[model samples]
Target chain A: MSLAELQRMTRGRGEPRVKQETPDNKAALAFLGPWLVGVVALTIGPMAASLYLAFTDYNLLEDPRWVGLANFTRMLGDERLHKSLEVTFTYVLFGVPGQLIVALGLAVLLDRGMRGLTFYRSAFYLPSLLGSSVAIAVLWRLIFGGTGLFNSLLGAIGIPSSTSWIADPDTALATIVLLHVWTFGSPMVIFLAGLRQIPREYYEAASTDGAGPWKQFRSITLPLLTPIIFFNLVLAVINSFQAFTQAFVVSGGRGGPSDSTLFYTLYLYQEGFGAFRMGYASALAWLLVVIIGAFTLINFWASRYWVHYDD
Target chain B: MRLTTSSARRTAAAAASIVVLAGLTACGTGSAPGAGSDGAAPELSEEEVTLRATWWGGDSRHPLTQKAIDAFEEKYPNIDVVGEFADWGGYWDKLATQTAGGNAPDIMQMDELYLASYADRGALYDLERTAQLDTSGLDPKVLDLGRSEGTLYGMPISTTAFGILANQDLLDELGLELPDTSTWTWEDLSDFATEVSEKSGGEVVGISALNNGYSLQLWARQHGEALFSDGSVSISPETLAAYFQQALDWTASGAAAPASHQAEMAGVGLDQTDFSTGKQALAFSQITQIPAYEAATGGATLEPVKIPSEDANEAKYSYLKPGMYWSVSSTSEHPAEAALFVDFMVNDPEVGGILGTDRGIPSNGAVRDSILDGLAPGEKSAADFVAAEEAYIGEAPEITPNGASELDTLIARYLQDVLFESQTPQEAAEAFIAELDGSIQSANQ
Candidate 1:
């Protein structure tokens, strides 16, 4: 419409409302345009394609052939898939909680006024920065290798040690879990932020009532911090389930030492790229989505009992 | 508020229009020049063509490969070749992804184990039909190694033989004589290695256990079985069990490094290996690796010997393996140009001299003979070892069966099980055969 007509419409009371509708819709569409394109092209498009491919047989080089639910049925008999799932679940079970405990403990210690607090915070946070990196994984291999630093340290203390921690199936997953726990900086920072937001009045009131420090923390700190803890817990669980690079690099990308370190994502990578079983990999991917979705849904459902939001 | 809303709408409209215009321009400029031109050799038409070439290797090989690509570009001014290289570990995954996306390099370096898988899936161009690549200079036997079902899908760049790599210095230090490799059985190997361990006061083992699937295949071949034949696992469980048992015995008797130590060396390369670092007297190696092992040991003389066999006359353990292959991608826009580059890599004496046994002995007989004098002492020894074993070199095993690539991980796991005493040799063997059979059967389906 012309500028004069638009102005005249705005001047009119009831008729102006009708004229405003088209331009308002256009403006909203313009605001949403880029994000809509991205969601459709990058996210939704791939998800749809993979959902279709989950039922097919694809080796990447050739066209995917329809096999209905054969890929899913094949997973029933796949021992490696079972092993990978077990390893992944174990990692998440221990690693997420262990990491959160370390992160929160350090965050609490740092919350107490101390000298060189920034330096300590940075130092504590450094491992997380380097945690998922390939270089750190390689360093992990050297430190845990037979005749390496760990064994050498043991020998210096008059204990004879010959085990390669990363190479032994029994200890390989544990070593990776240790690496996971070392990278608590991100969640620790989140917890620090959460602690800072808690008003000092509540703790003071608890103290005035002759409450012990532990009692004050238990009554005042934890309840107020439950929401943040819930948030961190969900994030940690999701991140742990998707852990790949550290296991990939440390295990030499084959998830070996008898598949002890075969995280779920690592196995999916092997099937998709290493073995060219892209169809099976797509099926695995969808299954992961379902698994993660179910876990998150359960966490939210259970949060009603524990997570307390002040607002 | 009404004025603000109308003005905001106008601003949004203007912003959206700009974005749409920018996107349109981007789409227009992104189209390649003359991308849809009709059937004519682009190289001959004075149209510039860019072809990507990818390979996996160590630090030394990358620069040499880049230099060769530069030389090719220099020779063919109309053709530009982009070189992609990585360490061996991540190369296959990258190549597989690129191939799946239908954007693989015009020329790719292939391994014998995965050559059949790629060729069978129609990811490789048939070299027999590519006229620009001359195969006449290559030995027919060497050339045939890259063929799948009589179709030439890969061009052999070099040849290597699997054998025992022994540190002569360590053996001499122990005052141990090298076993007669020509007729040595597995028992002889064990006894000799045990003697070395004893004499050295346990400072070194006699050998590192041969646990790789390729090594196991050699053992199976010596027993008149192929690892895979006719699209299935052909090695009997008895043979597989025997192979695992020998490894178990070696680890048990100090003929090989301790089980834990062997496990540590699983992902290590030539530089940090026990044999290369003088921690072990002997290890399994391809003849091509002799130079690397020699270099890693600070010039210690490393010698290649025949792999041990049970029967002297029936010892079919040693065979010439293709060091690597050069194959053209099926999706290459400029196949003729890629073929020319492959021809240069295979037949050019200068390229051979520059690469100089780094990729094993050259597959082309002419290039092989020309580069002999230029080879290092260690490389020369490897070449001599290959020549000496020509008479005993058995028939090359069937091009590795589809899905057989997974056998390496399976064998390593089973071998680890036996070494760690988690499972008996028979149990590991039974599991291994069942797993391998399943993999092959799935691939066939």
Candidate 2:
């Protein structure tokens, strides 16, 4: 078609739409292009490959041989997988709720008018920042060791102590859970932000209505902070499910003291990289995505009952 | 959702243009490496070949390795070497990804723990034929570690022997003689450690009670056990039980640090503890760790001795372990060049002098001698000690299971369980065995 003919054919299409020069659109495209590439290359690429890998027997060396859900089948019979699931579920069960409550409680306490609030807030939040760090994990091990600072302090107080708090299987997971709780600063900060968002008028009104401090907290603060609490709860669940660095560093990346600290993601990492079971690891990864997704969805569903967004 | 006549055409045209642009970009990236499409060696040119090499090391080793690479580049004007270094913590994860992406370095520093995994995956080039490497000068044991399926996938860079480093000064004060390492048993080590603690009014223990890879290996050896035999989980129930009992007994009697303390040390590593602080008389480590040990102890004199074993004749307890290996990526277009670089790094006298026992005694005998001769006094003493121990190492054991590395975590966790709570030896042992079996089974499938 000739340019003249093509122009003539479209001439009657409403008023000739004025083409806008959108520097913003051009800039947005330019800006997002690299980000899109990175997401595809670094994140989505592996994710897509992992999905494919889940059904195959792809060791890092050879070509992936598709076995069609054999990995999932094997997982059913895998007692270690079962144990890891149990341990991980237990971790998510205890760690997520425990961390949220503590974080919220601390956030509330820190929100009160008090001296050295900044210092106390920083000191508590400091662990959250450093909690996942290798150094902090090492320090945690030392503080909890039988001859560690904790036992040493106990001894100084004339309490007899045994040398192994972290080594005992029963207490090993608990120690990690305590670690999860100690790093409550992240959620605490979120809760603090949430607390600040609630107008002072609600609490004041509650006070005016002859509501005691406890009643005010129960009726106003708790309801108002529900969104943040829910947010923290969901985040904690996902984070707990994917906990790797702590368990890895604390247990020397072995997830042990009898596999008590073997978080699900750590096991996935071990399978994929350490054991070279990339295929199985991919399956595990997808399963985790499903697990986290389910938990997050469930939390969202549960939020319907408790989370109050005081519009 | 509805488009007018001109708008629909514009949208279609835009989509077509996008498809073309993306296609072109993909083709451009895909074609970049294909410029040297022929797998044949490149035609000689004046342009320098900037070869990228990566390895994991601490700050101490980084400078030395950089210096060595610089010296190599200086010697070979056509080769410009780029060095990428990281701490050991997550090195393997990076290497594995690089391998998967088919952009692995020309030269990669590898660990014995990963040699099989990398080689089996074809992520590493067979250096033997490609380099036509003459192993006439290399240690047979070190050479053996680099071999997979009768082909050499890597060249051993150095040797390390795991053992207990006793603080001689502490032992002397306690009037406790270092046991005859060759004939000493675990029981002897434990008993002596307890005696020192009791006698010294709990001021010191005979050793830093730490659960480590060396401890696990040593324990397996002591009970005539193998952590993995013939590429299988072969640790006997009796051996596992004995190992657990020994750890528990030591912790219970206060002869060693409690499990939790040891667990703490697990992350920090045994090199950073009361032993290095000049308090604990003995600590477990590899011979290559001597440099770090000496530095941490403030130049306090230290010696590397064998991990005490029950049977003196059984060499299962101790063997010359390769500190590191130089591997050429299988995907490399220039395998010969990579192999040549490895050969130069290992056998060249100048490179050896610069490296100077930095990566353990060089796997090559000639290079080891050069490094030994060039070493400063302290390093020279370490070299001498290693030479003496070398004569006593028996037949090197078979390569461990593909999942052998996972067992280290299992051992550490079992020990951690014992130290933290009142878990019995049987419980820890059963858990370890079960976990090991599970890991091995999963790996096999």
Candidate 3:
């Protein structure tokens, strides 16, 4: 029904103004109880605690000592801290693009309408489900280990290699990046959903105008998919920056091979839990908030230049 | 379509939530080593007490410890013992979080490096006044190893010493004979290792380079220095230079595996080391791991050879390290029961029989004598090796100082630089001293 017609029906041609019944506020709150409790207790409570802790020297054993900006200043001289930042940035830079490309490629292929659609979608989505798990990380370690399956695979094909990819300073980060790239299923799903939204009539119109598939994709699909692409890009970048489990399990928790796979989160964990430097770890966390915040701000600003809308 | 707009908004909302969640990754619940449960109750209560006694070891060690716990529970039916176990690295992290949360385990297996770190922070119970934990069975020197600032925070459970552990079967296969270990110098050891490597046709290394700080201590002692003295690094740069030079020499001569291979084996855990896998004729090991290594080697006979000296007739500087200790959490409500459990772990012969040399050679003489017949061949030789090396053993070394638990990590990183030739040995050694000194000073603050 038209909005005016619905409004006229509800208003009865403006004959009289009727009073609206108020919701049972207590009942509504009761229904929202679990979610409210979760946000307040799990999210807001700890967030406040960590904020206070960020400015103090909490070594876990004693009461937190106020250290002002000491923890932040310490990061300036901490070579390992800088290394972890570099590693995290490098990971995101390489990993996000690789993942989005693969996800988009598969999404495009699947959008062409394949048989066993459900099965193929589920199969492709499997890695993303298992990718961040400890079992898969351990499998990565074994697969890239010195005498691991990868080397045997190489050996069987008349190539001899003995590199422990996860233990090599030069190659360790690359292995983790590849692991990130391989788990492109979630973004692929998003891309697929976005693809379905583009009107078939638009493609028909474009095809009648002598546009080839590449030109059609460039002129039609690309612009329509911009918002989805932007969404996936930001998510992927943030997620990549926070990557921990694969690096943790694969590198045996020290982020070894001389800290090659030391994600920022992993280093924060080592500082807080391993060394009992909770205050410094809290400070590191806030620094990450700033870093992630700045990146997000940049992403939002950049979106203005490229994001398209039907309006 | 409205579906299109809602789906896009839904996806955007989902992505935003992920970002929000990831931003809160710093919100943590675990705690660390600390003083707690400083409750007014000091006396053992008649009430039913449930104690969480935790330790770290391989899967094999778990059942043995559980058996001991079973025996303890049988002895004191009113007191229930809950056994918690984890791997070595994760154990500290767990204990720290628990203790910080004021819920530390009642009984904890402590390491030398971290004993003072915990005790000095008041995280551990002071056993100085506790009469429940007896020290009469342990050597005076060995007992004193647990003391920090006049407080007895840990009780020595067993002791072990470092030395060259040779895989005898590998040696036999390679047709190599080790020289008399007691009289052999570093040069002699190197030559023998090179011969083994050559004989094995590069299939095996003589040893994996010791990436840990323990070997640094052994090397320093041989040169009349120590890794740390008076709460700072006392090992001279010259000693470090020569020590690193030896690693380079070994690698260049094919006596030790290359840096890449060594790095590979480091992450594979103790059971997969070159010596454990029968890929090396000789490797650095402490007496505590003899049985485990023997098992890892798939039944290869391991023979303990004394660590080679700078000069055969010089001071041996051999000291027994109290391999690990039993500690009580200050936060533990059942301190008396925890002490009793530690006492059983050390003094009970049946418990010793169950643990064998798994922890190390038993520290209590009576317990050691009683368990001798029950030990596996691998463990028996380890016990015997300690016995035979006793004549040359030096005075027990001081307990590790606070803020030094991560020295092994620091050393490992610098040692990698040395192995990878990223920095000159002298340069890395100087950097090591500066970083360690800063930490020790700040830790004292």
Candidate 4:
């Protein structure tokens, strides 16, 4: 019944009636209560605290003291901080593009009907599953060590190796970036899923129009896959920026060979936990949040120019 | 939609149960304080209290320590102890956070590198003020090691001395006799290592380059210098240069593993594949580390030989280092009970025997004597070596600054650059001094 009619029925015209609550509304409230509690307790609460800590000087052993903007000011002058920022930028710059291109290429290759396609797709997805593991990082370290299997293989080909690829200051970051790029399977899987969503009739129409595979991909696949590609790009960039465990494990948590592979999160780790500079680390963390947020915003803005949507 | 609703209900129910259980546990009157009939009994109340303790160790250590904690709980049925163990890579970070959060455990195992920092910051409890402490049985010397600014911050659980663990089988295979620990200098040891590497056709490395700062400190102490002053680095530039040069020479001749490999083994304890499989001929470790080394090689017949000194009186610089210490938190609600438990853990015969040589020979002299008869053969030899080297041991210093641990990392990194990057000792030294100054200064502030 209409609210006005109900009010008129319940009370004389022009006199408001108070509606009583029902069991269903109470049940709905009960159901939504836990979710509201979790959102506040787990997510928003810590976020607010961390933001406050960002402005303080809190060593883990001592109570946090208010020190307005000092941690941020110190970071601005910290050489190691600058170096970490540079390293993180280099990683994101190279890793995101490399991963996206390779993922798309593989997705297109797997889009065609082929024998044992299921096995191939599963095989391609394995690295993404195992790539972030400690065992893989350890394996990566051994493979890139001076006397490692990689060097042994190189020796068989008569290449005299004098240095460890991962331990060399000049090459360590490159090696990690390569590891990041190699774990392109997840994005490839996502791209493949998006590819399947594009109807086969569109491709057939392009074929009838005498467009070759390149022309067809440029016009149809590229435009349709734009959204997915953007998604992968944003994810890869963020993950690359936050990369820690690999560098921590490989460098023995020192971020060494002269801090060549000192990713930003690794530096933040050393600051917060290593040196007990939780306050400074909190500032760094918020700065990272801002950075990732800005990049996401930029990607979303850029998407409007190129990304196509059917809906 | 119906299934989703049902599942949501299930999740809510589960969550509610968890919350209820947690609240009940939090407010439970399980550990209510009580007075004994005599009101003077030193025994803790039968009321139950659960506490969390954390430490870092290898997989083997995890089980051993867990068993020890089980034993601790069994003896004190009223106390439920939870153990949080992890590997060395991130141990300090975890402990630091727990302490900083002001929710630190009633008991924690810490390293010397960090003990001083924690103590100085008043994060640890002073045992002397505990109502039930009976430290009268503690060895004067062992107790002295934990004293900082006239207050005890830790009780020694084990004493360790760094020495070279030689593979006797490898020496016999090389047709070489054991180097005399009393006469061998650093140069002599370096020569011997080079000879072994050459003879093995580089199939085996002579020595593994672990103990980055210990080696440098050993050398500097031999020359009558120190790494730090009242709270700052006091080592001379020339000493550091010579130390780096020697380390580099060893690496150049393949006496030690390459810098990269050594860095990989930095915080890994003694369980690396090479050490475990007897791939390396010699490795450097502390006395307490013998069990790990021996177990790794599966009793391959090894001996702990003194690390070579640099001069005639170089032994003066070498000393028995404390492996680890047990301390109660300053914020503990039951300091008296904590101290009594600590004393029992280290001083009582039954507890000491059961915990036999796990942490190393108990630092308490009486407990050490009691456990001597039951030590494993390997542990006996290790204890004997440390005891024999006691006369040459240097004075144990007070707690170090919090910045000291970070300096250790800085030192290790610069050492890597010196060995692997074709950087000169002079170059590394200057960079190291600068970096050390920066970190130490920051810490001082």
Model 1 lDDT tens row, A1-311: 89976677667555534334467667876898798666655665567667877998888777777899999999998988999999999999999999999999899889987899999999999999999999999999999998779999999999989899999889999999999999999999999999999999988888899999889778888899999999999999888889999998888887878788999999999888767788899999999999999999999999999999877
Worst 10 residues of 4 chain A by lDDT: A12-21
Where is model 2 chain A poorest over a 10-residue stretch in terms of lDDT?
Answer: A16-25
**Residue range B1-445, candidate 4, lDDT tens digits:** 3445576667655655555344233321213232112333334555777766677766656776676667777777877777787766567767776665556677777677777777766677776665566666755655676766667788777777778888887878887776777768877888888888888887677886543556566666877887766777777888887777877888888887777666555535456656566667877777666777788788877888888766655447775555677777766665556666676666777777667777776777788888888788789898898888876777654345556667667777777778775568888887777777666566557
Error of 2 at B404 (Å): 2.9
Model 1 segments more than 4 A misplaced: A1-20, B1-47, B313-317
RMSD of each: 6.0, 6.8, 5.9, 6.8
Q: Rate the local accuracy (lDDT) of all candidates.
A: 0.83, 0.73, 0.82, 0.74
User: Model 4 TM-score?
Assistant: 0.86
lDDT of 1 by residue, B269-311 (tens): 7788888779899888888888788789999988788877777
Candidate number of the best lDDT: 1
lDDT of 3 by residue, A128-238 (tens): 999999999989988998888999999999999998888788898999999999999999999999999999999999999999999999999999999999999999877
Q: Please rank every candidate by DockQ, starting with the best.
A: 1, 2, 4, 3
Q: Pick the candidate with the highest DockQ.
A: 1
Q: What does DockQ come to for candidate 2?
A: 0.27
> What DockQ does candidate 4 have relative to the true complex?
0.25
Off by over 4 Å in 4: A1-32, A142-164, A309-311, B1-53, B59-84, B136-141, B267-269, B273-276
On the 0 to 100 scale, the lDDT of residue B136 in model 1 is 92
TM-scores of the models, in the order given: 0.90, 0.82, 0.91, 0.86
* Candidate 1: residue pairs that collide: none
Score residue A311 of candidate 2 by CA lDDT.
Answer: 66
Q: Which pairs of residues clash in candidate 3, taking residues 3 or more apart in a chain or in different chains? A: B31-B96, B31-B97, B32-B96, B32-B100, B34-B123, B36-B331
